[model samples]
Target: MPKSPRKRALSSPHDALFQWTFSQREHAVGLLKAALPSSLAAAVRWSTLRVEKGSFVDRALRSRHSDLVLSARIGEGRVYFYVIVEQQRDVEALMVFRMGLYMMRLWEQIVRDQPGLKKLPPIMPVLIHHSDTGWTAARAFQDVVAVDGPERAALLPHVPCFELRLIDVSGGRAGDLVEQALTALGKVVLWCLSVSGDDARLEREIARTAAALDEVLQAPNGLAALEALLRYLVATHARFSVRKIGRLLEKAAGPRAQEAIVTTLDEIERRGERRGRAQGERRGRAQGRAQTLLELLTARFGAVPAEVSARILAANEAALVAWTTRVLTAPTPEDVLVEDGKRPAPARRPAARKRARRS
Candidate 1:
């Protein structure tokens, strides 16, 4: 059969972009500083910041979004501070509830990972929202709960309540972000992601961001970061065409920027080709397996029924393996197909009444 047209990539480009950009220690620290309160931010030992592995939020909720968890020493090395980066494209009304759940999960993980820990780390949840519409939902978990007047006061002590630090990037003001972000790379990334929806603003700010990144680009990891950013822009924004971006790069940082852009685009194309090849190989293997099972069934039990044949062909790799294994010892085709240790129940018909004899 002719292969169906390749579907668009299953993964969200925004998720990939967010993870790649903020995974760096400097960028993560910059984001934390910008989002956290001045007093709280000052207490964090920025140099001791480290990204934690695994996610606390449910996998279903994180399907097309990205989050970061980091731990840093605070209180002059006496305590640990936890920061959760909840990056979302839209405002969520149940964000506080989700954050609360994530916090509990994080604490559980901490206890599991550190057997002798004396205390749980203090957690600070930050919501990084970037949507066309500004965030208008309640920022606190208490606000989400149903309580009125005196009842609310009564329930306050019993309820788990906390607020998330909010960073709204909906305005798409590159200058303000640049001033707010701590590092040069952070500024550029924040500007790019913030202005992704606005072509005019992105074009206006690209030159300034490029100039700022020039010094950083000279560093060892600068070129890599630049490539990542360019790839992110191309992947996340529909307005960012290669030609347009290439021209912008050339204008901003001249030949070096152009070279970086070409390199990044080439790498992206290579990855896509590799993924396509791998997918084709898997499909070919699956088809071969299906065909082998059908041949076995036909040889062992004579002509396979259309329904059975269809089921065998539709079966995934695991099911095919199970059927293939059963074909050798099963007494009949139905026995081979039906699940192990279970038989299909016999059909029953309704009985006719004999009331006419009485009449």
Candidate 2:
């Protein structure tokens, strides 16, 4: 038996979106099948794919430990696929070396758990690179070894080096998703992620990818996924407004998505001022402040549950103001907004005493 996975609180907006979309078994399976080399994809047992819990990412690099780990029957035994979504805006040459570190840690964990085991199962590291800039980093650990090929070749036998499978979903490769063996929702989510950096392209891609996104809405959790994807898109592309995003969704999924779009728009757009939703309206207003607080909470803590979203929406003006102030310093949503299944009442200003009958 393996250690159970924890309820990881993803820290970045990108991580939250990826975790929510890919963690679903259907999507995960699709991603793994497509990303794996054809030989392995053909041989692995898809029915036995199981998501494992707990992360092995180095704590020095991340505020929150996260990544998707899954195992499946390959041959007579098992194999692990450690999947991590890297959303760097620039090329990270050290990414594979870092991935190497993560893989070693995972192997160590498996060894610790099964002390009597003679041999270790193979762990394949798959990196999903989502960037505005396409991936330009070296794919193998040896590529970054800082030695000439001749010299590196001499030392290579001793170096415990490995390579990672890459799936580039940067702005330039959005169309590649169509060829990949992904579900409709997976394609839509990756498509949205791919074009997030190009606002103009996103508008066009939304229509181009409309069919898949429409299929996404038909799924049970499609609405929630759509909301998360839109929030991320609008949040990252400040130039895109809620109305614009809603219109895009309406255009893509038809007018029926309007209600869901509006509800999410209102919730997501409050801080529209910050994320380029409501332009030139950066005043100290209630809705703008509320939206900002909501975004901050989601970025740090993961998706806010519906009840928590309602609580944020229902908060008094003072509470909204207080929560916004607290969110900057607070560690969790509970630290900033929630307390005892509710938010603590906003601190009140003391009444001033009047001079008695001075006249």
Top-lDDT structure, candidate number: 2
Instruction: Report lDDT (CA) for all predictions.
Output: 0.69, 0.73
Q: What range of 10 consecutive residues in model 2 has the weakest lDDT sum?
A: 1-10
Best by TM-score: 1
TM-score of candidate 2 to 2 decimals: 0.68
- Quote the lDDT for 340 in model 1: 59
lDDT, candidate 1, 168-286, per-residue tens: 66665322232564677766666666776577876786777666667557756766666666665665567678567666766776667677667766766687799899989877887
For model 1 the local lDDT of residue 209 reads 66
Q: How would you encode candidate 2's per-residue C-alpha lDDT over 1-359 as one tens digit per residue?
A: 11111122113556666777777778889888778777888999899988887677766645322488899999999999998876657777788888888888888889898899999999998887776568888988877877775677789888776888888877757322334688887777777767755788877777877778778777777667677777667656788776887888888887766677777677655544454643344333666667777898888888976666777776666778777777767766766876545755655668988879956
- Please give the clash total of every predicted structure, in order: 0, 2
Question: In model 2, which runs have C-alpha deviations exceeding 4 angstroms?
Answer: 1-11, 63-66, 149-151, 174-180, 263-359
After superposition, the stretches of candidate 1 with alpha carbons farther than 4 Å from their true spots are 1-10, 76-90, 115-119, 173-181, 195-208, 212-216, 238-253, 316-322, 334-359
